[model samples]
Target: MVVVKGQDTSEPGGVPAHPAASASADAGDEAAEDDRRPSPDDLHELLAERGLAPDDVDQMVDVAAVGITARWWRNTKVEDWHAGSAIGALSDVDMYRINTHTTAKVRERLRRWRREQGLHTMVDVADADPAPLNRVFYNLYRWFTNPNRTLIIGTTLRDVVAQTLSNARTHPDCDVPDNVTTETELEDYDNQVAGAAGYLLESMDEYDPRSVLYSPALFATVWARRWWGLPDYPSHVDRVFAVLADPGHRTWQNRPIPPPPDGVNLVDVRKKMLTKPWELPDSVCQWLINDAAEHYIFD
Candidate 1:
């Protein structure tokens, strides 16, 4: 795919004198004025004269072709793979552009997709059942291959928290809560929430089985806020955990209905409940109820 330019090695009559002809003045003079052009071999010699060895020229051509092939494959094959699903209907050219996208561009697109899918944090993936988890894996896999995919996959609670914070940072309209502007502040908040969630999940034996089952809804409410672009204040975060820690303190309801906070759009929440209530796991439902109760108490 690489073309190398040849240097002109013509003499006065556009002919090159043969080596043997140079032994005699008369033969050299006759060959010099022959007016014949150089052959392929003569061109090679001319290129060599310019310091480009045959082997070096071959290597350069090969390297250039390889680089072109690699770019084409990355921008073609990967793009088609993503187009296989209804949700991923990007054109070949669009996918190619995405393949070559800068980090900020990729993150912006990823944030939009997350918003559309209502996926706020890595915890959503971590706590997902097999079906949801597989969907998440497939979505991520379509964009990138193995080692790079690892960058988005979270294996631990801490990793999930870190990923959640990272996503928040990428969101253009993100409204970080007070005390959570810097990396250190965000990490501290992550630790607090993770510790609380872990303690609640682990302390299930201490609470009534019915209440413990209901506790998942409490966590779900917190997760839901993330989907709605609402900030998770420390007080509310601690309160959700506290309620989970003491499930027996309050009666468990079949459904916990939380009033939408001021400025929070209820359209998506309402739509999900009306059309896809099953998507709201029991934990999320409980959190909704507790959220309503807390709102009432504060009011």
Candidate 2:
């Protein structure tokens, strides 16, 4: 799938459709990674089995509005005036390094981060946690037309949940739902992303008949995550990650996907990540916290 610049609407045919990633581009090369990630189909089946779907937004306007709302929720605190950071960084204990974090560790940590931080929504997220995710959301959310940050796991639901919980937790008065289990179901990073893919599949398929809840534009966001950067980009990360970290998007860069280490166990990996104790710039980390104050009127 080729991403076209300035074409933000993810309506039908808004973006180019390459064959689904489950299929491969190169027939002869085993090295060529055929979007081995689970297809939306497989995920939809899982969601259906679990009985879930999108709320069904009314129109493209509605899609963009909800999308924008979610992003706005994330970015309410990009500036440093309210942030307590002397130079705009979270304290040493609060800083969570994206790299060096094992996939195994990220998943459990992501969920736990949410539970401890209280980040179900923006208000809750900012009121308490105040991490960098909000800033990135604000910077990248181009009226939700740009799926730069708002996919199932990559940006939309998962990003909000993960960022809120992980950055520093979100709400204080808001208690985690009694039904919401703090247990760790999926531990692997790939598995977390995979579960998101599955949820998106179910959401899109069911909402196709009569709603704006899950529009085609979302697929574009998904496409971008799978997007292969040109040869010029870094080897480990794709272009999107690079773009977020680019000079222009510095405030939005936040944490990285963590470095990939071969043959590392979870316990050992967490030990290593904790040792570094680094996050994105301090200014970026506090955006969520500040924004939450404004939105949720956090005390």
Which candidate comes out best when scored by lDDT? Answer: 1
Q: Kindly list the per-residue Cα lDDT of model 2 for residues 1-299, writing each as its tens digit.
A: 11123433221111112222221122223223323433334433432343333221122222222222221221122111112233222232242222112222322333354466655542342244323323322332232223233332223333333333332223332223333321221122222222223333333333321111122223322332211111111232333334423545444345433322344353442233234323333333233224211112111
- The alpha-carbon lDDT assigned to residue 101 of candidate 1 equals 33
Tens digit of lDDT per residue, candidate 1, span 1-299?
00112422221110012211221122124324535423324433543453333223222222212212122222222222233222222333332223223222333443444455554443332332334323432343343322223221123223323444444445453433445433443233333223322322332323211111122222222222221111232345345445534545453345443434545444453454333333444344444544544322220
What's model 1's lDDT at 159? 38
lDDT of 2 at 133: 29
Provide the overall lDDT of each model, using Cα atoms, as 2-decimal numbers. 0.31, 0.28
TM-scores of the candidates are 0.18, 0.19
Model 1 residue 183 CA deviation (Å) reads 1.6
Off by over 4 Å in 2: 1-187, 207-292
Q: Candidate 2: worst 10 consecutive residues by lDDT?
A: 73-82
User: Model 1, which residues run further than 4 Å from truth?
Assistant: 1-181, 205-211, 216-273, 276-299
